[model samples]
Target: MRKLSMAVLVLFLLTSFGIAEAAGSYWQRMAHGYPNQLVVYEYVYEYVSPELEITARVPQLAGASDVNWQDEFNASIRQEVQDLVASLQEAALESLELEQVFQAFPYVGIMDFEVKLNRGGLLSLAIVTYTFTGGAHGMTYYDYINVDLTTGRRLAFTDLFDTEAEIARAAQVINEKIAQEPEWYFIDQFTPGLIAADQGFFLTESQAVICFGLYELAPYAAGIQEFPVSAP
Candidate 1:
């Protein structure tokens, strides 16, 4: 990671100082954007100044059904997840990037993360845990994020970016990375046993678990999950 950062830093410095080799179309293309998956899209659009519109979608994969345990609860969760993804993606394009946001507001340390109110026909729940490695307020952070059943606006968002330019640049970087990754790539994994609902056939743990592995790949995704794990 250090090496990668140094390389990027050096490249940035050289480019900024007009010392690096003139990048060709390929290099420029490489810098354009990373590959993106529609697994679940969170799109945000700045309709006006204060009103940001959001939408979400779920990607249909060849083997998603096989891997995922589907039921009324999970189905509902999936829809909400899809909606949240679309809404957030729009927000990413509209809102500032996390880096810029964090730079703007350095006081809010990310203690946790979350996504809630996903519903298929029934309620669905999921949670993820994370440990911040770098950037932001302070300290190495670790916390869990969850997503569960709800009605209106299954997800909530709070970002720190300032301008659209920053968001575009950051998105470019992520798009590039995703482009270079493998298929399904297994961005995340679920916990051991399914957390079923109270009913005999369903599992509904008050808190759904977030696959830290997948959530971490969030940068690669469109926007951050709606809720922070530690929030009330």
Candidate 2:
């Protein structure tokens, strides 16, 4: 009976040590980096001095000749555009990649906002536009800002003047090229079976990386990374 009890105690101690060792190893990986981990695309923004500012102007009431009218219109427009710029800056700082800014700024008043895409002689742009939904004369003017993502520089200064059309065009071009080839292409290609099992899925390469990333990190995430593996 003493021998039997001794055996039971030894088994319990061994099991407890194994569990503790596993938990310690997991925490160590969490503190450091994962081994044999998949490479994920993370945007490396190069900070530069401000250059251009994009403003959205809302038409004023009564007369365009009134200096106060122009001032008010300009003020309103500047406020709105500044708000947009703030939100965009926040998103850029927080995002893992440039493609994330699309979902981040759905309500930003940029019109005809689209990633310029070219396929077999066909050019396409996802133009997003913002219109005043209500109010006197329907709209007002706000501050403007422009981003040169290629250089990681921004301009909201008067010296950096650019037409709305030009700003939209530049953003679209950047978005399109970024969508086609992200930093995660090689990583995703190496582990295609885990992320892109179906070729029919209309996912951009960047999106595929994100999808796979959520999958790999979900176990440690607080349910925010619960992604659909198979769509209905």
Candidate 3:
């Protein structure tokens, strides 16, 4: 009887491990570029779960009728790459045409992204930086894309929280943390109202990361401010 019980427990553990392993999807990095000018880098995920769908759409992915979820995902990334490259090319041509007028430096564009979190059916990504044609400085931004693997739809900030009260609490916590490092921000006064639900945010297993773009809440020297609050 003791041996039988031990065997049963081992079987249960193995089954649980199998389920966990099967829940995760694999991904691959891909890059596209234009001669010596613009380059776009992205990641493509291989989704195996029937419950999840990639709902983010682009022109190329929208027209396809028979493609699987993985194909649609790849197509969407490709469409984004094409759009980015085209925009940069247009700007580069304009810069060349106006080279004598403005006498500005040569134009080049760079876009790169990474998968920040991909587990338990929720996937998040950060589009680290995207710098087009010409500017005094390149703008760095974060893109958090969280999707419900079970539903296959992109989730908004509200979807992750149960109530407005929870959001308020999270905001309060973030504000408090920022206040502790007052030098990190440029505000003479910090208010809870400053933190909005529509603002950029992402989640980890234990915390929600609320972020601000460069110069949004502070000076450019301060860089991006990301405050992680305990998940409610």
TM-score against native, each model = 0.18, 0.20, 0.63
Candidate 3 per-residue lDDT, tens place, 1-232, comes to: 9999999998787544333333332221001111111112334422211221121222122222224754666566666656655565566666566564223344433445655555554455555545534466766666665544334466676655546686677667766866788787777555557765566776565566778888887887888888776644
Clashes per model (N, Cα, C within 3 A): 44, 32, 1
Q: Model 1, which residues run further than 4 Å from truth?
A: 1-70, 96-126, 129-232
Better of 1 and 3 by lDDT: 3
lDDT of 2 at 153: 28
lDDT of each: 0.30, 0.30, 0.53
Per-residue error (Å), model 1, residue 65: 18
Worst-scoring 10-residue span by lDDT in model 2: 200-209
Give the better candidate number (2 or 3) by TM-score: 3
lDDT of 1 by residue, 70-106 (tens): 2443465445444444553455444454444423322
